[model samples]
Target: MTSMRTLPQSSPTDETPLVALRNLRVGMPAPDGGAPVIVLDGVDLTIAKGEIVGLVGESGSGKSMMALSMIGLVPPPVRVLSGSIKLEGRELIGLPERQWRSTRGGTVGMVFQDPMTGLNPVRSVGALLTESVRRHQRVDNRRALEIAEKALLAVGVPAARERLSAYPHQLSGGLRQRVMIALALVNDPKVIIADEPTTALDATIQAQILDLLRDRLHAAGGLMITHDLGVAADICDRIAVIYHGRIVEEGPTADVLRRPRHPYTAGLLAAVPHFGSRGSRLEPIPGQPPGPTRERAACSFQPRCKHARQACALAPALVASGPERRVACHNPIEEAAR
Candidate 1:
């Protein structure tokens, strides 16, 4: 793990950030004495109050790891070498486990990608929901149950009262996800981190879940992690494009989507399927992302970038490219086609 270091921040707001992660580096052990396989490298992000920031990237781009770090749930063996996670301007890097446990579901609630993984199979949904609220809020069983029912109803869980005794496997995938969202909201946390909340569901269920999160779930701000840019564009106020553990492009959703500066961003957008486009073939990005253990000196995407040049031999730092756009490329793409 690298040492925690501070970096220059580029935030849209001058006011304090609700959640700020600066110079965060995370990695796993290498075969020998070589550098650790860097999973996250000097990532800086800010989520202001009332803002919904989307963290979009491929499978191994460190999206979920960043979310776990926020909730102090970063899995072991993958250590956070150095960086600062601040909540309301308070540093959380060095917080004791005792304090982190208190902060987990209380200050920051997480809605994982799959409820099947996050939920207990043996326990009834009612028990799972009530347990979450009870952990953060001091309430008796009856009141905890009441909060659970309200939370379920708020998330569109049908027959909320009757569903309490049902096991997670008994409900459909959509219903189970609704319960997860409900559990996350029951605590009324100040911030929410949703890691691919709509991943495994069908199209209809996905839309319904997104609608619920966007319209009903209220909090200080949110960090939504997903591989789908369309989903990000649909719900996020801003989007941060991560490639090889680094944010290659970030800006307002409209700006990034309308005028993507990074070739990687353009590549991702080109892969999306537009509505009413019958018989249209979806363009997929060529080549797979480098493995986690693969080391690189220059641009990680250089091998795949059509516009890569000799200058890219020296890696580029994320720099301001437009009024609200930042891109980390020696030769970034021009504004995206309208």
Candidate 2:
């Protein structure tokens, strides 16, 4: 298990975060079940108003579980042990299910990666959209349809009024993805949690979806979960690099991307195929992250990090490095930009 000294508390920012979590921990059933596996360990993050913060990591890094935890959607056998999850100063950690339902579609919304699984196969798109608005707004059928139409039109869904009558199967992949986004926006939520939204779409459609979320929707704040460093750079104002249930590094997107202090973040950026570096082979991170049940008091990435040292035996807490920058590493890289 990892152990770290508590970080110093900073002066409160001028604006409070729209969504905030401090010392949050979550547990799930382990593969070789003797005890519950720790999925997230003392994770802290915040999304400020009117900004997009991307959570980037490789698959199976608990990024998606963290997303689910934010909105209180963590399923059975996966439960929060302790800590605070606050939205706009309201405590969400122990809120009852009834209260959470109101907060879900009304204040916070989720857009899953795959539209097919998210949408019902038997229902018409209109029925789905109409029901979403009615569930949260409690409006009549006619009013609900009107809200859905406006939401679809606002997201640039072509023939918004006509497409409402079509079912999920009838639409193209791109249009279906747009429909899912429209579904998330039907209630005009303040915080949108999009989990790997671009993974299933083509490059052209992915650009469109990102633009819609960045420019149109998410005026308050947003949490975008993505594996692509390039996508994080494109839309995220700030980026958090998560690995093995902890944040390795976080800062303004430019700062983290240009001068990654943590080796994991640097490795992720290195794997990306830069436009100017076409001739070189794509560099991938050498090893896998520790499993859910596995925990290390020392650096878990010691095996993979080329920069590891004897001092790395001690666990490192996420410490402030520069303006709006934090890294959890003993041997942080010093790049020219810094």
What tens digits encode model 2's per-residue C-alpha lDDT throughout 250-325?
9999989999999889888888888977789878889777888645577667779988999888768989998899
lDDT per residue (tens digit) for residues 1-338 in model 1:
13222333333235668888999988886659678988888899988888899999999888988888787777888878899898877778888998998788888888888866777999998998888888888999999999999989989998999999999999999999999888878888779889999998889999999988886433458988999988998999999999999999999998898888888988898888888997888877889998775465788889899889999987799888878778999988864433
Q: What are the lDDT scores of the predictions, listed in order?
A: 0.86, 0.85
Instruction: Give the Cα error of residue 143 in candidate 1, in Å.
Output: 1.4
Badly placed stretches (over 4 Å) of model 1 are 1-14, 31-33, 216-218, 277-281, 336-338
Q: Cα miss at 336, model 1 (Å)?
A: 9.4
Residue 169 accuracy (lDDT) in model 1: 90
Model 1 quality (TM-score):
0.91
Tally clashes: model 1.
1
* lDDT of model 1 at position 267: 88
The window of 10 residues in a row where model 1 has the poorest summed lDDT is 1-10
Candidate 2: worst 10 consecutive residues by lDDT?
A: 1-10
